[model samples]
Target: MIGKQLKPNFIFEASWEVCNKVGGIYTVLSSRAQTLLKEYGNKLIFLGPDVWQGKNNPDFIEDKKLLKNWREAAAKEGVNVRIGRWQVEGKPIAVLVDFQPFFEQRNSIYRTVWQNFGVQSDKAYGDYDEASMFSYAAARFVEIIYLSLIHKNKKVVYQAHEWMAGLGMLHLCKAAPSIATIFTTHATSIGRSITSNNKQLYKYFHGYNGDQMAEELHMDAKHSVEKQSAHFADCFTTVSTFTDKECAQLLEKSADVILPNGFDNAIVPKGSAFTAKRKAARKNLLRVASALLSEELFDSTMIVSTSGRNDFRCKGFDVFLQAMANLNSELQRQSTENCKTSVLALIEVPCWMKEPRKDLQQRLAEKEIPNTALPNPYLTHELYNEGEDAILNTMRSLSLMNDRNNPVKVILLPCYLDGEDGIINKPYYEVLLANDLCIYPSYYEPWGYTPLEACAFKIPCITTDLSGFGQWVDATLKHRGMIENGVEVLHRNDDNYFDVAQNICNTTIKVLNANKTIRNKMRKNAAALADKAQWNNFIKYYYQAYNFALSKKLK
Candidate 1:
């Protein structure tokens, strides 16, 4: 059984995404900050790589005065650091390390690790060195802080996120034995690599050997580090059982505890405020799409979206576009279209953004939006790789342009929606409320934060069984994929691509066609699911992990 609360603690959580708005891990750490801070208060701290160097990172609020003594000591010991608070809700203390200087001694550092742990670095490539150096540097700083300052009576726990921070986790395990270390592999490196390489991961999952697959896929260096760290850390944890199984099979270690990622609804507006922001968000959505397409969208239209990183096959962007294309055809064949237009699909995945179209900008600024479609009317921002962008290519192949006669219109807002992205100048969650439906048919996902976040925002979301969130919905909520129930968790496996697409197409058709009464019920159901997924409900699992780590250290 998972254990209990770790009171009076000195906790240090490390992640490559601590203050960096990269992916799901950032959401995991940032959303959990407030709860952790409430328990540990000023004793809670986070260590992240200083990837931005001296440049301003909007997510970070630096204060040289925050830890002056520690900063001076770090400087004296050759550990370059910047002490600050993460710019999220709790404003929890964060320390960003500049690991750039460690390149000079990389060979020595690598040699030391190879000697201490059997992490072979001979075949390392790409971001291997960079991630290793960053984690290694974080480990050194953690060791210094623990050995030199922290009292023996102080209960200390250090948690490292993903394979990128695995080296740091292992380092602390070896260097500071008293400091309980936890390693969380959000997704196994080999598993993701196998899925991405188009291998039938689930079909032959049991038949495969992790080491053999790693050698075949050229993921030896990363897999070695991740595997070792998982074994060495006092408490090895994963976000969900889906990945827990993956670790056991691929990394050869079962997680001691499953710390599922949770959401914090503090940023979500209540009652009257929610109604107002949602109205504003809808207005923004319609205006942006209408202005870009130069055609007015009726208020009765439904806005559909799929978002997250631009990993085409892995994130299932290919399937989404194909499904939307099928949706356009299906809606066109309908006896009579009830809604103003069938669907307004937004591909909010960030990629190769050059700038927002000046013509589109001028149109939005005008008293009335221009009636003529701008050049490349389907795209919100100009892309540097327009000729080769996967989304654009897929859309063109499926003939999904925002043609004036098409019932379903598609637009690609391929830029980060951080309020300053020339079009739709609003943060992601602020605009997320406008969506009538959200879909994430991930081919390779560990926890699937997008679908969870979508459900939390009261939007009916359709996800696949392969995603961790999707599995949780099936087991917890009884796999009820009815429109009246809000979420549709489709059965997706390595072999069922077309089936998943057809399901998404049918699901959207049914959900978007529902009447007002049914839609409200769906919203209510989605919100209920979100309530169950809040950090308050999920934070106990983390304490359980910490408690286990502390117990392991005692052993």
Candidate 2:
């Protein structure tokens, strides 16, 4: 029988990036936690790695006790258990299994995996312990719950995020065959790993080797973990419809439903009055840009912005940079009259890892290549030297390039943002208010959140046709080509870099040059779009998936 939680309306959530900060998963849990809490009350238990707690914290106390108990119990089963908890925005979350084991052992799990097999092409795929930690923590938590309910049994709907958490779900399922389970893969390792490794980019993760080293590690185990989570879960849900399709294909199983990710509108300030805040933000951006370029802003300036973790090649940051560079170059070549506009791009990419060892070598190599070489089909980074050169030049160009036509200024800001921080200091929305257009040229986005954020602020945005947001725009704007001229979609493979760059330039120019009458119409349409994308609509699907899973378990 599917093991039941001993309580009513309980949710057991496990994510690698929960209480510990990581990627977009943290955003999802933070924003969506309220909804879950409202629905399930005290019964919802969030689990993740507690990466940032210390000895004096109250959470450390509970974690030490929990970890001690679990470690003692699991010794009989030849496994280790590290556990902890902390409050993020006042949410009770479990940091499962201490990281000391993995760190102290020098990630022996990875060593063993490497010893067994050759490296694989995808670095993200090869890590074996990510899933093991997930499974261990999950099983430990389940064991705790099971023990708690020895006298009075309750039911739980265990939902796991990505492959890391999938391990826990798998162990839980095996231990209690009849308990309902749900799996949500915010993004897949295979697709992203392919993009990173094939391109030879590994700055995001420290000590990540391209496919060869990955092949040596046990990638298959994690793949199996993900596949089994799909196969075993009573219902499977993904962040976007496109992601759902990708996961089904990857897992070789059909998904039960699509529960698209949503942001808390509360985080975003309301009305155009936020306009004054934006203007101030723009002024601050100009100051930073001016300092970087060692020049003051003169004449009409248009700010363009994009924000995310830095995976420039895949995220289309490279494309946007190229477009801005090309536009600046063209404007410089033109007569003074033609070069009336100045553009600055404020880019904030949150990089997680510190520079060290092999990671440093890769970073330095990427900095050696010139920006001009990246767009050349013939000069693409296929050869090792070419790739290394391209990366180096990009870095050099990032540090020391300013254009006369449009001086594209890039900013690398932190990913973690809270409201108390001045709105002007927050990279994304601050730039959106002052900027003319936001660019997202993703090659493999399941759902693009930035575009939606841009739309919410009534700012024009450019996203590629491959993104789920772009597809939605296509469907929504069958008759209306430009959606009030606030957002535009570009095809990634439509033409060469020159053509793509020109399109981005032309689109941004068109939006900015349009009269006030057109701009007002666009803002109205933009707000309407944001209103339609409420979290309630998205969460309904999740509820339905849970209901379906519960019914299956009962049967």
Candidate 3:
């Protein structure tokens, strides 16, 4: 019952994260670039905001010769751009547009958008103005490229990501009706606002009105544009079935397709290389931990970690800390029987850090594991506002101090792991390889990438059913729980905070007590699950999305 596949002759993709390494969308675009390049080659043009103008952008390489004709034409139309190749796999063509000039016309542009698509921008704030200008400029760039370079007989598709690029999609719909448009919302704005504001999204999901919620949340501008784009785009899509349902309820538009995020497995090391890197990672992680805690951690010590943006409650940092406390209590009770199970749990989430702890730096420099603890042994970096910090307050409340004799020692690394974050001095993936287990217990994760990345590295992870990835894993593994199947999909709901914490504690204990054969099987199963989620397998949904958009254009 498969239908004929329709492909665009030329494709133009615009996103705020195109050349910028900001969050999960960058992974989606960068990881999948090679596959698109193999199929479309130079005809697939990526339009991004020129946020790194005049700077040495490591992710971008400007080549004046690549699109000279288009550059000249665009200049004549007042569209300043830098044509180059993105420094990812496949080195696809990119156009970083200077969106600053369009800000002068922001009011008129907003008026036009409202007139055409009913996107209310009057109450817009924060990044609304900046994102809208970039979107308008991107749309203008697409229009110029289509008219000057692309022939009239050819079919073209413009795909925009998130509300940040929704304005551009709306623009193309009005200016270039012949060109098909696809808008993908990774997470709905209202949904995120609802969750972040400590409101009950799932319990009141049906009763809440999108417009009223947006107005109440002061998210009218972003939500309006996102909803309008979904209604107007030739095809609307989202990253997961969870978000698909969110769109249906919040945006009042069903997604034309579900475009799940996929990772590039080629980035992962294989065979002995993987073994070597993992060993190195473990050594480095333990070395840092030992330096900070003043204790030498050996091969028997279990290294567990959870990392993401500092959405303490939403990313389940609260549950993670609670689980750690519970685990510590369990370990303490077991220690009475002379049973030693050392666990080094790391919280690698980024926060507003003033700098690395000077005492920890001095300890690392001495290259000697001290017998005594440093000040605030739980934190690697000093926070800007320690008194108001949620994680610190929670740790204190739970009495989960990073005691030297405590079997479960927690370390807070509140900085990005870019190989220069003083303490770790290693990149994220490099350090990730060292972990025995990773956990991302998200309360509102649309498409969880951390778990996917962990699985790709052959690391077993725990994620809740509230996440899109967790739901997918549940379906894939037929509801076989964690440790045994690599990914443990715990059933989480709004009211089960303590219950979820207990489950996480129990699961961690189970993994820690697992035999070598069982752990190896779990790792193997995790890797197998990750292989199924590679770009090669998941890119078909995108192809379906493109075909849907093209069919709409033809219609």
Candidate 4:
């Protein structure tokens, strides 16, 4: 039986993205980490894969003094763990586990899991084996920590993010019963698979059976692990109401807690500092564009960007490119000076790339940019899969070749912007701060952090109703969101490709044509919206979830 609300004395969170910076989950955990540290202090422990086993990971600094006894104990059991502090806004204790040795024993582990929790991984492919092995090792690490250090009576909780970490929670269910478990599926594998495969998710959501869909889509292993984890975990949570529904239908389980993603304002620039950064960012962006495109650009040039995972249809890269094409065509036909003020749309999505463009790097290094445009002037980097890339292919189809006369010049910055990419040499956030407008027209987003981040930086954004953030904005405004102030939540469904493209074109033009005074107000309004979504305001939900899990006293 559950008692009154109780706080967990200790928490161990496992995610594939602990020291890894692969996807949005990294953003989710990293941004909230500081606030979480404030709440739990050193009692919080984050476990991640030891992907950087040999080389140094700048994000993690191992402290031999910290958790010395536990490391020794774990090592004795063939578990190699490096206890360190993650270098982010909040320096929380992290353990990077080396699961390489455990790979040999995966078959036995999977067999036992199949017998106990019905987790089937026979057909698992690609990263599934690696992730399962990592999770299994993470769970083993937690078990060691609990047995060797943690008290029997102390309230404890273990939270796993995504299906990649599901095996760990399931492992803990059998190995460590005293510790409460929480499994969070950011997006159900089957649901995302369905969307990416061009099947209508919303229209036929109710009729689809998750298990049937899993087998049909060949996502049985992922769906199986995730589904079992939901049933096995003591408490289940999701990042948004949108995903909560997806979990309900696609995974056959709804979240016990809806912990919406939030931002930490501590990382964001403030007041006059913000102004200086924004101006500097804009200047740097325009300067780079001028060097690459060989075009004279003014301060009036609006820098717009769209960034996320390079899931072509899922992230709406196709629609965004098509919209840019449409907008370019419209602006070319117009005579006004405002139309002549070029819109520089940057595609910040990362992909399989060789390196920074050698010619672009040379141009950037010069004291003065050459008057002539470089070959493939639209690309910030050369790609290994130049002919096979979806975004580049779509751009070719739409003829967004960044011609000098085009009013909208599109540049694809196809590498991760971590300030050391040889060109641009600025982090995504730094480059983002300079944007006059941000467009994240996602077709399938659980909780859109990009738009929220854009708003937090006082940049106006255009999102769609399908995104959880966009839905929240619409609800906050008491109607469908519009560009009159900060966000514009355009209505998007599976069938309206060109219609959505035209709408994006229209909304972006409105922002480009806006005067300085109107634009400033828009920026303020965007930040005001962001203010309501800080971790300080949203962290309560996480605490509540912890308390609920603690009260259960799963032991």
The global Cα lDDT (0 to 1) of model 4 is 0.88
Better of 2 and 4 by lDDT: 4
Residues forming the 10-long window of minimal summed lDDT in candidate 3:
332-341
TM-score for each prediction?
0.97, 0.75, 0.97, 0.97
Specify the highest-lDDT model's number. Answer: 3
Per-residue CA lDDT of candidate 2, range 1-555, in tens?
Answer: 113323336677777776655566776776676666667755666776645445343333355664455456554544444454445433554545554444344345334433433211133433455545554555555666555442234566788888777755765666676567898876666546656544432223223432333244345555655666677787887777776666655556667877777655656666666877777777766654443343465425777777765676667766776676666565567545634336666665554413212322232244232233112211111223433443335634744244333334444333334322222244455556776667887766767788887777777778877677777777667733363556677776524556766788777666656777886787667666665665655666667777777777667
Q: How are the candidates ranked when ordered by lDDT, highest leading?
A: 3, 4, 1, 2
lDDT by residue (tens digit), candidate 3, 277-340:
8999898888877877777789789999999878887799999999999999988887866434
Query: What would the per-residue lDDT of candidate 4 be over residues 1-555, giving only the tens digit for each residue?
Result: 224567888989999999899988998899999988886899989999999977979899999999999898889888999999999987999999999999899999999999999998987988999999999999998898788888888888999999999998899888988888888888889888998998898888889899999899889899999999998888899988988988988788889999888998888888899889888888888888888888768888888999998888888888899999999999988855544538999999998989988888788788887778998878888899999998888888988888766889998989999898888888888899999899999999999999999999989999998899999898778898787769999999878989999999999889888999989889889988999899988988887788767656644
Candidate 3 lDDT at 111 equals: 94
The number of clashing residue pairs in each candidate reads: 0, 32, 1, 0
Q: Each candidate's lDDT (Cα)?
A: 0.87, 0.59, 0.89, 0.88
- Which tens-of-lDDT digit does each residue in 435-549 have in candidate 1? 8999898988888999889888889898887888888887877754555567788888878898889889998888887888888888889888888889999998888888888
- Clash pairs, candidate 4, are none
Screening candidate 3 with a backbone cut-off below 3 angstroms (N, C-alpha, C), the clashing residue pairs are 482-488
Give residue 5's lDDT in candidate 4 (0 to 100).
60
